[model samples]
Target: MHKQIIFNLPVKDLEKSKAFFTAVGFTFSQKFSNDQAAFMHIVGDDIRAMLMTETFFNSLINKPVVNAKEGNEVIICLSCESRAEVDSLIAKATAAGARIPHPPEDHGFMYDQGFEDLDGHLWNLVWAETGV
Candidate 1:
């Protein structure tokens, strides 16, 4: 069975992407990070993201990269402990130059909100009852 997962994404500016995610309350692993790429730690060491420069990312994939700002590629959804946490992350991301793509949603047992990062990646923050 697989024990770890990492999502590789292309970024125009590594430093800016790092800063945006940092402001959104995420930490990075310096051990796997350098000039061309940043190791963004999402859920400890088990699940993470590699924010790479356009040149570097292009070399890893054979097809052309999608412009996230212009079209939909993938939506990264994260589970939050509570609705407050979801809202807080959205607010922080907005303050860090992220664009709020949609309004918050409430469905009795679940709450959701989302923001677009500096590189136009759509990240959804969701809070749901654990027992449900």
Candidate 2:
């Protein structure tokens, strides 16, 4: 059985992507990082994300890269402890050169904010009420 999982994402610039994610509170694993890719540690058990340069990622896959800005291919969602935490991350990301795709929205049960990373990848930061 597999004990660990890693999600690989194609990026335009390795350094920029690393800097952006770092600013948004993610630490990288230097052991897996190099000029071509960076390993970002997500806040979960046995989960890591790899940010690979466009050329490097393309060399590994036959399919063309998804234009993340043209449309939504996927929405990476993360759960935060509080709404303030969500806002804080959004602010930090924006300050680090990420683009705000939309304003924060409240749905009573959940609060969500979105930002586009340096490579146009969309990330949704959410805080959901778990108590009934």
Candidate 3:
């Protein structure tokens, strides 16, 4: 059984990407970070993301990298404890140069807000309480 999971995404600038995510309330593990890639910690579990440069990422895969700004490649969704947390994270991301792709969604029990990171990666912040 696998105990940990990691997702890889490409970024043009490692320093800039790290700064952006840091301002948006995310942390990184310097042990896995290098000139070619950075390991971003998702905060709770062993789930981490490797932010690799396009050149390095290409070396690992045999396909053309997609321009995330033109079209989204994936939407990374995160669950928050409350609606305030969802709103706060989105606000922080936006303040850190992320764009709000759309308006926040309120489904009574579940609330969602999202933004596109500096590298144009889509991230959805969702909040839902028990017995809401």
Candidate 4:
């Protein structure tokens, strides 16, 4: 069985992507990063995101890369410890130049908000009451 999941995403600018994520509080594994790609740490070693330069990413796939801004690629949702944490991250992301596609939603048992990264990748920050 697989012990980890790494989501690969293509970006227009690797350095800008790294800075944006850094402001949102995501750390990278320097050991896995280089000029054309970065290993973004999401959940320790269990989950991760690979931000790759579009040219480098295209070389790995046969299909043309989707332009995230013009279309929906995938929404990466991450669980947060609390609703406050979700809001905090959203605030950070927005301050770092991300755009909010919609307002935050709260359902008593769950709360969620999302942002569009520089590369237009959609990411949702969610918090759920434990044991739900």
Q: Compare the candidates by lDDT and give the number of the best one.
A: 4
Give the residue spans of candidate 3 off by over 4 A. Answer: none
lDDT string for model 3 (97-122, tens) is: 99998999999989999999888989
Instruction: Please give, for residues 13-132, the per-residue lDDT of candidate 4 as tens digits.
Output: 999999999999999999999999999998888999999999999999999999999998579999999999999999999999999999999999999999999989999999998999
Q: List the residue pairs that clash in candidate 4.
A: none
lDDT-best of 1 and 4: 4
C-alpha TM-score for every candidate: 0.97, 0.91, 0.94, 0.97
Higher-TM-score candidate among 1 and 2?
1
Total clashes in model 1, counting residue pairs 3 or more apart in sequence or in different chains:
0
Against the reference, the lDDT scores of all candidates come to 0.92, 0.88, 0.90, 0.95
Q: Please give the lDDT score at residue 37 for candidate 4.
A: 96
Question: If both were scored by TM-score, which would come out higher, candidate 2 or candidate 4?
Answer: 4
Write down the lDDT that model 4 would get. Answer: 0.95
* Local distance difference test, candidate 3: 0.90
Clashes of each: 0, 0, 0, 0
RMSD of each: 0.8, 1.6, 1.4, 0.7
By summed lDDT, the worst window of 10 consecutive residues in model 1 runs over 38-47
* Arranged by TM-score, best first: 4, 1, 3, 2
